[model samples]
Target: MRDDMDKVIVERPRRGGSWQGDGRAWRNSKEAGSHLGMKRGYHRTKWLNENLAPLKRWLHKQVHRPWDKVYAELCSGIDRRSTVQAHIFEHIDDFVERGAVMRDGQVWVSASWWGRGGRAPLEEASHVELFVHPLTGILLPNRRLREARAAQRTRHGTWAERRGDKPCAVYHVIDENTQWHRVDGCWFEVTLAKFPERVDAAKREEKRYDVLRRCMVTHGGAGRRPAPDMPTHASLYGRNDVYAANKRQLGRREVRARLGDDA
Candidate 1:
């Protein structure tokens, strides 16, 4: 009963609403009207022709029960949802919410003729199979399961992966805030506070340098005058607050030269 393990989800075969309705309709066709045993106006013959008769033969072989007997039992509520009731329906929701069913002795699901008892994980699925508590039925964690869950909850990806590589345009800032972040190829809703911590401070410096290089190109090379409307190298650096505390690192002369002010 280690706390580290998570219970695997139980998956039942999918059966849509039409299947449920058809099965219920088939059952109603057998009821009689009057004195609770008399024939009702069920249009029994038309119902047989349109619905039950079409599948009667196939169901006979599938369930290995004579069609008449099965139909009688269905009318008596022996099978509530289909030609054969699916075994998983009885406990699927319970098992799903509770997360685990007892293994070996107390397992409630059983295979039905029409479908499997439960789904099996595909060959490529990454899963952890671990022991359960004999009395309380709690899952016991292995080393792999614990580590995998830990990484999944705590480790996020780089900033470039979380957001796009380029800076979002100022015009799109409102729309951008509503957008989601991507981590490990899955999109997740992230808060503004958590967003800033995805990358280290060094990565932010690198991004500023890259944007400055792009601005240099747009300025038409170092020491050349930019048009009045175009953003200058000085503007890009100042707006990004690049190295504000340590401006002396690059020296005033080199900064002016790079900004094209030396010309």
Candidate 2:
């Protein structure tokens, strides 16, 4: 292998751009003593054969471990005092190309290895790939992952966004009901049985956008709004097809009787 590494398989192109011709043919044809560049050329060729060629070949042949294993190993080896580990962990994706398939709680490496190998199993794997830590099972949200989640949230809008002001003030009405709340672009659904308890819980947390409150006060007639901001009653409540269908089925008289005349 060392002898093979020392051998120069490809020669530099000659001045006229022909690889068949020797680069140093003209110089070598001259008297040996007259070849001023021979020493530099010899050392350069030696360095390339000894160091660079082998490195390039090795890099081309190198096979990376599965992403989950790589992540687990990296996290296991983390040391707060080591700058190298910190840098590697910070740009972990750069070291490995991730391609995985997760099903039935098992993660399988799908592709992206340089050398041939069978699919590997990942321990402690999440049922779905992306953003999940391999070992700890904690979600590590990346920009793409976050963007995808945001798109999903927008496409299917949360229960709160879908419900809008249909049930009146959601914060007031659903305060004691188990319903979803969209906060900071993420949704959390919790069950509460009392209004005061929900108020106390909200007070203890960081302030978040009150989407339900804004919708209620602005469109549900709890407060006056500018003409531009005010949407028609049908527009506000009819956005949900299921609710609209149910409302239509109930008829105005039945709806009024069940939900009161204001409904």
Candidate 3:
């Protein structure tokens, strides 16, 4: 939130008056750009919360296509945010070079692209959680929820970063930002209510097994069925009867030369 005035190479022209009228200040494009970029991020986050907060509860209904609703709302919100960030991102290097914004050493964003792209480059900040949920799919006890919420962070990558790098926590560090982004291969941001579940200890160990073991284990649902530790892993009980009846219609098939005669 602090401006890197110390890093501002050229003295900001003294404010003879309010922005437009000030001759000494706000005189040129670069200085003006820096100011706009820093401020726009705030406007964008406020707008998103006002408009999209309702979808959080609406998305949880267990129904035929509730996920589709969640996806649609998220796409709209994230895209709006990204659009704003892209606008502010245009002038970040001026600030960054001077230390207005701080970043990690492993930079996923390039200063040149971010600096020059103007308002066109901001990708939606999707599934952005104002409220915290487990990065893992399971709903934790309230005590655990407080802990998870405290540690929650936002990041830039498309998929949930299960590795715990806390990727992209800076995407909105200053209320606004710009970067390349997408969800389901389309450009947008998604504020997730829940973080994707982490691999359980057994599943982590299972990855080392051969393909044959994987097939056998899945085919049998056999290892001491792990506890219902995650909401995502909870059994899908409702739709099985409906889907099973129609399997022939959805099942794979092959063609043969004149079925009876060929056989």
**The best candidate in terms of lDDT:** 2
- Over 9-52, each residue of candidate 2 has an lDDT whose tens digit, in order, gives 22233233222434465456554455376343233332111123
TM-score of model number 2: 0.18
TM-score of every model versus the real structure: 0.19, 0.18, 0.17
Show the lowest summed lDDT stretch of 10 residues, model 1.
Answer: 1-10
Residue 156 alpha-carbon offset, candidate 2, angstroms: 2.3
C-alpha lDDT of all candidate models, in order: 0.30, 0.35, 0.26
Worst 10 residues of 2 by lDDT: 240-249
- Candidate 1 residues lying further than 4 Å off, grouped into runs, are 1-86, 89-132, 135-146, 149-180, 194-263
Clashing pairs in 2: none
Supply candidate 1's per-residue lDDT for 145: 36
Q: Which tens-of-lDDT digit does each residue in 1-263 have in candidate 3?
A: 11321223222343322333233344354544544543432222322112221223333332233333433443443333545423333332222221112234221222242334322111121112121122222211122322232233333333445555343321111112212122222222212112223366455322222121112122123333333221111222111111011111111122112122221
* Candidate with the larger lDDT of 2 and 3: 2
